[model samples]
Target: MIRQLPLVAFCMMAACAVPDYRPVRAPIPAPQPEPAPQVNPQSAKERFLRAVEANGCEVNASNSAVILAGATLSQQDLARILQELKDEGRGSVAPDGTGFRVNTGACA
Candidate 1:
């Protein structure tokens, strides 16, 4: 009976042992991105006008005609742009004296 009592006391002491604890790691968040800048697209008429201006031609606002010099836009490039404008129904290009008259539907 005395030996049984000692064994029982040891079992009770074992049951009162301290518990171990561990820290848990947390997850990181992602960074936010900045928005892009806004840009306005150019119209077909605007593009054609820019091309003529780039070639150093004089644009007549009164009749929408561009005075083409000897060193102005090449014949091939002019023809291509004129054709494109015609196909899109935006305008037409026709020979007017020394320069070419451009019939742009809307200057806007």
Candidate 2:
């Protein structure tokens, strides 16, 4: 019993000993950047018409063409608007009988 007492004491001492422990933290992930806004083709055309109006021209878009009414714009101004639309892959613009026509390619 005396010999067993020492073994029991050692077991109790081992059980009461402070355990080595450390707090672990998970790694934080980096924040992702926001995606760019998508451009709508119909809205693009509308905005183009508004821009033309602001530049002293009246413009409207139909199924077959973009009609210019009331105000007359200089060839340079007209060309600039048409080129911008074309470069955006929106459509091809050509002068029709009384107005300009935009043959749209596809929506953005």
Best by lDDT: 1
lDDT string, candidate 1, 1-108, tens digits: 997998999989887775655576676767778767776566544556665555443334432334234224544655676667668765444455444444443342
What does candidate 2's lDDT look like per residue over 1-108, in tens digits?
998999999999998896868787888989999998996545434655554544334233442123333223444555676778668755443455344434442221
lDDT (Cα atoms) of all candidates against the true structure: 0.53, 0.53
Give per-model TM-scores. Answer: 0.29, 0.29
**Candidate 1 residue runs with Cα over 4 Å from true position:** 1-47, 51-72, 93-108
Question: In model 2, which runs have C-alpha deviations exceeding 4 angstroms?
Answer: 1-5, 16-79, 83-97, 104-108
The Cα error of candidate 2 at residue 79, in Å, is 5.0
